[model samples]
Target: MQSLQDALYNWLTIKVVCDVRPDDKAAVETRDFFEEILTAQHSVSNIETTKDDLMYYISYQQGEEIKKRRYPRELIEIMINQINQEPEKYKDYPID
Candidate 1:
């Protein structure tokens, strides 16, 4: 049997769905914008627009056990800004 660490080393897939109309340009742009930001660290499989929502599928190799949670766009922007302003503080951020 594989050890827990080994299992986690394998790529893990995650999917996030946003409730946005397929034809809304603003929503599409927002989703695409964030997708670019996230893809810097993870692999984005695909971003799809279904009738009711936009679906984002991504995968990344787990560096350490991270608590699964959802981050809003504003929060993400804030975190990025903080990291940029104080690189040393977040140089080892997320404590993987």
Candidate 2:
């Protein structure tokens, strides 16, 4: 069975790639971008970095349970830029 992480990844990929008629896709993208940034930032601080295995020291484990990852500030900034460049993408979309 696929883990929540895998499912989320699939969802993200679908959300980013698909151009459906829904007005909420943009919001999802923006939210996802911000989430990625935050996760990266937290990950860098709380987790120790190693030259050998990048994902070896990961503290969060996933299985039947859900796990949140660390987002990076740079990622958030990038998403912000995306939103800024395309203002209409995520405008007035309902927050999930």
Candidate 3:
């Protein structure tokens, strides 16, 4: 049987990789923005960046589950707009 601590650890640790197209400066900016949000939430265990993708190893406490998905370019643009327009709204919430 697994100990409670082990189970919790497994639940908290999640790895996700995000891929973006064009590999341009804008894509880099998007990755940076997401990284800042992740760092502020204390959920990033590791981050690996490349020309076209970002690999994130995240860990959060119980009750906080990070969803793993690919973010389309349009969504990234929307996130950039939101962050620029209402940075305060995201100050308390973890990155989605």
- Candidate closest to the true structure, highest TM-score: 1
Model 1: per-residue lDDT, tens digit, 26-74? Answer: 4345456555544444433333322222322223333443323223344
Q: Can you tell me which runs of candidate 1 are displaced by over 4 Å?
A: 1-18, 41-67, 70-96
Provide backbone clash counts, one per model. Answer: 0, 10, 0
Query: Which 10 consecutive positions of candidate 1 have the poorest summed lDDT?
Result: 9-18
TM-score of 2: 0.26
Ranking by lDDT: 2, 3, 1
Error of 2 at 77 (Å): 3.2
For model 1, name the residue pairs that clash: none
- Which is the winner by lDDT between candidate 1 and candidate 3? 3
lDDT, residue 73, model 2: 33
Residue-wise lDDT of candidate 2 within 3-48, one digit each (tens)? 4344344333333323232356555675366445435533212322
TM-score of each: 0.30, 0.26, 0.28
Q: Which candidate model has the greater lDDT, 1 or 2?
A: 2
